[model samples]
Target: MLTAHTAEGELVILTRSQSLESLRERRKQESFYCPQCKEQLILKVGDLVIPHFAHYQQSSCRNSFSEGESPAHLLGKSQLYEFFSHHTPAVKLEPFLPDIQQRPDLLVVWGDTEVPVEFQCSTISTSLVRQRNAGYYLLNMLPVWIILTPQSIQTSTADILTLRLSSFLQFFIRQIPNRMSVLLTYHPQSERFYYLSPIIHLQGSTYAARHLTLSLHKQTVPFSLPSSPSQTDIRELALHYQSARRKYLRTVIAYNQKGIHNQFLRACYEMRIQPVQLPAWIGVPVQGQEAFRQSDCEWQLLFVAAVRETRKSPDQLNTSFFHTFIKQFDGEPDDLLAACRSYGDFLREERIDIYRMDRFTDGDFVYEVLSGRFLAMYAKN
Candidate 1:
C-alpha cells in the first residue's frame, strides 16, 4: 500500500507498526512491500485515498487478501446503521428487517424477494454458494448479494505494516434513501453533522475519529414526529387549574407571562428571595403564616423589589417619574424607565405616596430607588 500526504482537511490512516519503527531507525526514504507477495510498494502524497499503490506492470505480483481495517470503512458502518434505523420504515419495508439469527453477510428484501450479498474479489468458495442458495430457507429472509474486486498492492517501502485487508474491506450494505436529503451543517472540528435541508433518497458516509461527521451530498429522510401535550392532558394539569369547571370554562387568554415571571426571578436570583402567598390565599394573613415561617414579609418584598431594579417597589409615584420611565415606542433607551414607571403607576393607585426622581447628580442610584418606602408592612404569623 502507498500513502500520499499534504492533503487538505483532516484524515488518519493506520500504517504498520514496523513502518513507524523503521522511520525512527533511518528516518529516510525506504522500501515497504506487500505482506503477501513481498513485492516493492509505493508511497506518495495523494488525494482523499492517500498513500495509494499501483502495480509495476512487469510482474503479476500484487497484494491478495487478509484481515484489514480503514478509518473510512469504520465510519461507513456506523453512519449506515444509524441512517437505516432512522429512515427505513418499519411498515413499508417490513420484509427487509435484518435477521439477528442465522445472520447472512448482507440481506435484501425487495417486497417478498430475498437475496444474500457476498464478495468474490480474490477468492471464491462453495460456502458462499451454499449460503446464498439456502439463505432464506434457513433464515427466512431475502439474500442480498455484493462482491469486491480489489486491486493488487505492490510496494517498495520495506516497512509496510500498514497493509491490512481490514483497512479497505468495509461491510456497509444498507437500504438506499427513498426521500430527500436533510442539508445539515458539517463541522469537522467537532465531528458533527447538523442537517438543515431534507434530502430524499440520500446516500452518504460518516467518519468519526475525534469528530462525528457524515459525508456530504447524501440523502436526507424526513423521519420525525412532533410530540405535543394534548389538550386533555393540559386541562388535567394541576399547576394552575383549580377544578373541573375551571378546566371546562372557555375564556380568551392572551399570552402567558411565565417568561416575564422568569425574568423577574432572574433579576432577584442572588437576593435569597422566597415565595409568599397573598393574604387572600391564606384566609387573611393570620390564618396561615406559620407554614411559611417568616415575618417582615412586606419589608422583604419591598427590599427585594428595589434590589432587583424591577421598579415594582410600592414606594411612591408621580406623573413626571412616569414620563422619565415610559417610552412611546418599544425598545427605547428609557424603556427600562417606562417599565419602572408602569410599576410605580400601578402602586400609586394602591395607596403609595407620590414622589419622583429625575436626576440625582450626587448620590447612588439605590438611594434614589429606596428613598420612598411603603409604611404599611405584612407581618408573618
Candidate 2:
C-alpha cells in the first residue's frame, strides 16, 4: 500500500524520490500499520521495487483490500488521485462505501454526485465487472474503470494493436461511426491515454484494432468519447471482412473432401451456389454480432438461403421463421436483432423490395423478402 498509518495515527505516503536510507530511518522511529485493518505493517524499502508498506507475511491483514498491490498499480492509482485532486478538492483515495460494501481506488464527490474511479491493472471476469458496475449504479455513482496498458503494447502496431478482451474490457466498448465499438487503456509510463477503436475479432482471443493516443498533460479540450467510425476505417474493415471470408471459404472447401462434415457448404454446392461468388450484400459485417460462434461466411450463407426460401414463398418470412433460422446458429437475441438490421441495410443499399419489420416485440418480428425479380437480379449480380 502507498499510504499507511503510523504509530502516531498519522498517514504517511512514500514518494518516489524518497531515499532508502531515509525510509529505513523513518521506519525505525515509528511503527507502521495497515490503513484498512489497523494491523501492524512492515515498511519495505527495496532496491528493485518501489518503497511501500506491507503487512507481515503471517498477518491476516495480508488478505485485506490494500494487500497485493503491485508497484505499477500503486503508482498509477496515486497518479490518478493526484490528477483529480488538482482539479477538485473532493477527491478521496481508497474510499470505502458502507452501503455497497466495496472500496473504490478513488472516489470524487461533486455536490450530491459521487463517482467511483477504478484503476484496473489485471484481468477481471465479466460477471464481476457487471456486478461492480451495477453496485455503483445502485448507489447513484458513475463508475469509471481505467485500464493500465501492458508492456507488450509498446512494441505493438501503432494503428492495429491487439489486446485480450475481458468482461471489464468489453464493458467500455463505445460505438463510433462506420466501425464497431472499442476499448480504452492508459499507459502510466508515458502518461498517455490510448483509444483502441473499431476492434475486429479474428478467431479466438485475437483482435485487429485501430488505436489513437493522447497525451494527458497537453490536452486543452475536454476528451470526447468517439461514437462512430470514419469512412476510411469502415473501408478498411470491409476489405478485412472480404479477406476473412475468402480464408473461411478455402478452409471449408479443403476439409469437405468426405462431404460428411460442414453440411452447410455441401448444401451450397448441391444448390449450385459458389461460396466465393456470393452476392456482395451477403457477407457484410454487422456491429455487436461478434458473439456468434459462426464465421461471417457461415452467417452470410444462412442469410442467402433464407432469401432464396423467402423468394420461393414470401409468406415464409415471419417472426417464427426468423426465430427458427437464428436457433440453427448459437447467438443471443441481440445478435439476431443486429443481423436483422444489417440485412435491412443490405436490402436498402441493393434497392431490393425486402421489407424489414419496423416494430419488433418480444415474440414477434416481420421481415418480408418480396420481389422474386429483385432476388434473381441479386443472384446474378
Candidate 3:
C-alpha cells in the first residue's frame, strides 16, 4: 500500500528516500485515496513505521489491503519490490488487479505475461490459498507465493532439515519439472532463502528433508532450487525412516489393549503374528501414505494378511479388492487407495510372494530395498 491516488487521480508512491518533513508536507497538501476502493485514505507519516496508505475503519473494500498487515509483511513486500525492480523495469508495487478483485503485494510483467507475487508472513488456511489461486487462474496468470520463514523453524544442519508437516507448510510444497518437490521459505530480516527439496514423510507430521540456502543478492526472479537428494542423502533418510518404523513398532507393542475394538491389534491376532514379529515389508513407507492417520504398518500388515489369505497372484488382485480393503480405514479413501496400489506394484515388480513371507524377513535386505527405492524416488537421473 505504498502507492495511492491523489484527488486528481494521479498515482503517488512514497519512497524510503523521502524525509519525514516532506511526507508530512505532502499529507497536508492533498488528500489521498485507495486505488482499489476509491475511498479516502489516511497517509500515516510515522518515524517508526514505513509511511503507507491506510483505509478508514468503516470502508467496505473487497480487497482488504490494509487489514492485518504486520511489520514483517510490510518490510518484506518493500524488499521484494526492490529486489524485483533490480531485474525488471516491468515490476510494480501493490498493483490492484481489477478483474480478479485481488491486489497482490507485487506484480511483475515477464515478457507478455503478468505474474502476481505474494509475500506471505502469516498462517492462512488451504481454502484461502485455493481461492487466491483460482482468482489468478481466471486471468490465466500463475501467482508465485513466497513464505516468510518462521522464527521457530529449525535446520538440523546445512544439508539436513526436519519439519512438522503443518497444513500451512503443505500448501507451499511445490513439485517442479526436472527437480524435486520442495517447500520454499524466505527470511526477510537476513535476506536468506531456504529450499527444502524432496521432502519425505516419515510418519505423522514428521518429514525428513535436505535444504539449500542462498542470500537474496544471489537470487534471480525465478530463483534457484537445490538439486534432488543424492544417493548418500537417500541412504541417510532410509536410516531415519527405518528408525521411525522401529519406534512405531515399539509403541504398538506397548500400547496394544488387545480389545476387540482395536482393529490393528485384532488384525495382528487374526494373522497369528505378534506385532513385533511382523515382516519388514509389512510397514514400509509409500509415496501417498501420508494421508493415513493409521501407521503404515497397521494397514499394510492387514493388506498383506488379506492377500495371503486369498491365495491369489499379484495380477489377480483387482479394483474390487482395493475398494474393499480401503473400507477398513478412516478419512479420505483416494490417497489410501493409491498407496495400497503402489505397494502392490512394488510387490509385483520385485516378484515378491506374499505366501512365502519367510524368505523376505531379513531386516538388512529390507533396509537395502528401502534405500534403493528412496534413491529411485528422489535422486535426479
Candidate 4:
C-alpha cells in the first residue's frame, strides 16, 4: 500500500517527495489510515524495505494490501507506477475499486479507457485470472497483465525462436482481434519486456514463437505488438514444426503404450498399421492445433482410422461426421472442428482415398502442407 489518508483526510503518497524525518514527526502527531479499508495504518520508514504504509497485523480489513507481496512485486509495482505516470496524468498506484472489490497494482487512463495494469510477480490460478478479467470487463476497463519473467525459458532449437509453454503460463496468453496471440512478461531487474508474439502451438506445450525484447524507457502508454514474422522467419518456424512432428512420431513409437487398452494404439492395430507407420498427412500441423492437450498425432490418427473404417471416398466424406467424431475427444469445439475440417478439406482437395491408405506415403508431403499450404493460409497478404 503506497497511499494513505491522514487524520485531516488529506491523501499522502509515499512516492511523492517527503522527508523521512517529517513523515516520522507527522506519524507521532497524527495517525494515518488506509485509503481502501479506512483502518489505521503504520508508516514504516525502514532502512531495508521501501517506505510504505502497512496495515496492523490484526486488522480485519477485507481490502488488506501487502500481505504476500514480495520485494520484487513491490519494486516492480513502484517502477511501473513511475513509468506509467510519465506517459499519462491519470496514473494511480494501487487504486482500490469498490465496484469490483479489487485493487489493481496500477491504473492508467488511456484515451477514454481505464486500463488496469497488474504486475503479477507470483503464481496465479486460472479461476483467479478469469475472475479478475471478468471484474475488469464488468467495469468496462481493459486489464493488462505483465508477468515476472521466469528463471528459465526452454527453446526447441537455437536457430529458431521457440518456447515450451507450461499449462500454468498458457493462462497469460492473449489473442488480439485480427492479430496473433502473445504472452507479455517483464524483468524488473533488467527493466526489459519480453514479448512472445505470433505464437503457433506445434503440439501440446511446444509452441513456435518469436521473442522480442524492449527496454522500459522505450515503452509507451499503450504497448505495441511486435511486427509479424518475415518469410524467412516463418519458414524456420515451419521447419521447427516439422521437427516437432517427427519427434512426436518417434516418441509415440518408443514411449507410448501399445496395449489393446491404449486407445490410439488400439485404433492403429485395428487399422492394420503401426503408430509410427501412419501416413504423414494424418498428423501434419494445422491451424487450431492448440485445442488439443495431447499430441495432434494421437487424435488425428484416430480420426483417419474412423474415416477409413467407414470406407468413405473423397466426395463422400461428411464434415458433420468429422465434427461429431472430434467432439468425442475433449477440446474447444469450434477449434477442434476447424482443425478436423482443414484436414478433411485437404484430403478431399487432393482427391486422396482414405480407404486406400497405401496411395499417400510421401513423407515430404508433410513439409509441403506445413511450409507451403499452412503458412500461406496464415500469411498476411
Candidate 5:
C-alpha cells in the first residue's frame, strides 16, 4: 500500500524523497492505518525493497489486501494510479463500485465516459474475467484490462511474442484492421506498452503473436480496433499459417502408429491428394477463424472434400448439406461462417462462381462452389 492514514486521519504517502532513515524516523513517531479498512498498519523500511505499509499477520482485512497481492503488484498498481492521476485529476485509485461489488485498480472519468483500468499482475480464470467484464458492461463502463509485464509473456522469434492464452488473456484479444486480433500488455519497468497483434493460435494454449512496442510517455494507449492489415502483416500471416500446418502434419504422422488415424488423411489418400500440397484456395488463411479446433489446413481439406462431393450432384448444395458439413467438426458457427465468406472471396478471385448463401434459417450461411471447374482451376501458389 502506497498511502496510509495516520492516527489523526491524515493521509501520509511514502514519497520518493523519503529514504530508509527518514521512513524509520517517521515510523517511530507516527502510526499508520490501512486506507480501505481503517485498521492499524505497520510501516516497513528496508534496503532491498521499497518503503510501504503492511497489515499485521493476524489482520483479516480482505478489503485492504487482496489475495496474491505481491510486492510487484502493489508497485505496479501504485505506478499506474500515479500515471493516470498525472494525466487527469478525475482518476481515483481503488474506488469501490457499489453496484458491481468490485473495486478496480483505478477509475478514470472523463465526462460521459468512465473507464475502469485493471492492472492484472497475476493469472486468473476465464470465468472470473468474463464475470468481471460482464459486470462492467452491465454498469455501462468500458473496462480496460492491462496485463502487467515480464510474467505475462515471453519473446518467441525476432518479430513474435508468445503469450500463454488463459481465459484472462483471451478476453483482451482485440480485432484490428485487415482481420487481425491482438492482445496488449504494459511493462512498468521500461515504461513501455506492447501490442501482440495478429495473433495466430499455434496449437493448444499458445499463440504466435506479432509484437509492437510503444513508449507509454509518447503514445496514448489504444482502445480502438486497429486499421486494416498491411502487406507485411498479410505476409507474416501466410508464413505463420504455413508453419502451423507443417507442425500439425508432423504431429499427426508421428502419432499414427497403426497407420494414419485421421479420417481426413484417409479421404485425401483415396483422392490421391498430397496433404502438404493442397490447392492454394484450400489452405488460405481467414480472419477470425481461431475458434475452430482443427488447423486451417485440416478445415480447408474438409471444405475441399465437400466441394468434390457437391460436384457429384450440384443440386445437393443446400442448407442440409451445409449444416451437416459444419457439424462434422467442433467449431463455432460464427467463425465457420466467416471463414466460408473468406473462402468465397478467394473463389471469386480465381473466377469461380462459388456463392455464399445467406437465406438459410438454421444458422449463418455457407459457401457453395457452383461448378466442377473450381476443382480443375486448383493450383499451388
Candidate 6:
C-alpha cells in the first residue's frame, strides 16, 4: 500500500479494490508529497492506480540539478556533448526513438547509425543497468557509456599513473567493459577532466553525495578506496531528506508551531544534514477492558484512557471535542503516546533493541526524539 514508513497512513492506489467514494474520503483525510525531489505527488486511494509513486513532472531530468546550473559538467559529459556537437553531426540530448524503450541522455546521429551517450551518476539496480544498455543496443544505437565522477576526486600524485584506483578497482571487480569509448573523471574545483583509459572499466556505482563527501575529505581524508554506494543507501537518503523537509514545512506552515518540525528542518538545511528517513508514526491499537493485565485504579491516570491535558488548548481548541481529547494527552492519542515515551526513554538509555526495531540509523536525529518527539502528528485547526 502507498503508506509512510511509520505506517500511520499511506496513499495506496490500486484500481481493483477501492471505489470512488473511498478514494474521495482519503483526499479529505490526508495529503502526501514526494520525499525526494521535493515535488507534490499524488496518492490515489482507490484501486485505479497501483500503489506506486509517480513523479509530477513527466520529463526526464537529464541532470538532477545537483550542481544547480553550474554550467553543466566542465570536463564532463556535457563537454563531450559540446565537442561532438561541433565535430560530428546533429547532436540531440535525451533522444527518443521508435524502437528504443526509453529516452537516452544523449544521442548523436553518426552516419547511418545513432550513437547513444549514456552518462550515469550514482548507482541503480543491476537489472536497470542491463536494461538501459540493452535498450540502446536493440534500437541499433551504438552505446557510448560515460560514467562521470565528481569534480574533486583527481589528485596530482595519481595523475601520472597509467590507471587510477577508481578505474582499476572496478576493472579488478569486473564492473566495466574493457572496450568502452570514453571514461572521463572531472574535478569540480579545477573544472578539469582526466581521460583515464580508452578501455573503460565500469565498476560499481557510488552515491554522488557521499562521493562528494569522500572527495572533499581527500584533501585530508583520502577518497577512492575502490568503493561504491549500495543502491538502498543512496535511494533511502534521497527519499528521506526530501520527505522530511516537506513534512516539516507542511507542519510548520499549517500550524506555525515553533518547536519540533520547524526546528528539525532548520537544523537540516542550515547544517546540510540529510535524514535517512522521514518521521513516521507507528500504529497503536488499544487493548480491550479484559485484555489489561491490571485494570484497577492503583496506577490510575498513569495508564488511563482519559488523561490530563497537555497544552491548554489555545482558546478555540479548548472547547472543541477533537481538541479536548488531543489536549488530554501529552504525546499521541491511543497507543502512540506510551510508544513515544517508552521509545524516548529507550533512546536516552542507548538501547540497541530500539534501533533494530525502529530501523533508525542516525543517532542524532533519533536521539532528538527524546526531547519533544513528533509525539503527535498534528491536530487539525
Worst 10 residues of 6 by lDDT: 281-290
Candidate 6 per-residue lDDT over residues 184-258, each given as its tens digit:
444433444344322211112321122222232232111123223244433433343334334433544454344
Best by TM-score: 3
**Of 3 and 4, which scores higher on TM-score?**
3
Candidate 5: lDDT of 145? Answer: 86
Expressed as tens digits, the lDDT of each residue in 207-317 for candidate 5 is: 766677767665443343433445455455456655665777767666555575796687567566555444444544454457665666677667656766677322335
- Please provide the root mean square deviation of candidate 1 (C-alpha atoms, Å): 25.8
Clashing pairs in 2: 175-227, 176-227, 176-228, 176-229, 177-228, 177-229
What lDDT score belongs to each candidate, Candidate 1 first? Answer: 0.29, 0.63, 0.76, 0.74, 0.64, 0.36
By TM-score, rank the candidates, best first.
Answer: 3, 4, 5, 2, 6, 1
lDDT, candidate 3, 1-381, per-residue tens? 688999999998776678879999989889999888899999988766788888888889744757678767877787788788887668888888889888898889866798999999889998998899999999999999999886645344546655677878877888766435688888877888878777767666777677677888999867786775676776766676667777877877767754325666777787677777777677776666666766677777788877877789666898999889888777678978888887887677667777765656655433454454445563323
> On lDDT, who's better, 4 or 6?
4
Ranking by lDDT: 3, 4, 5, 2, 6, 1
Clashes of 2: 6
Candidate 5 clash total?
Answer: 5
Off by over 4 Å in 6: 1-78, 150-153, 160-183, 186-191, 197-381
Residue 119 miss distance in model 4 (angstroms):
2.0
The numbered model that scores best in lDDT is: 3
Q: Which parts of model 1 have CA positions greater than 4 angstroms off?
A: 1-76, 90-101, 105-122, 149-381
Clashing pairs in 3: none
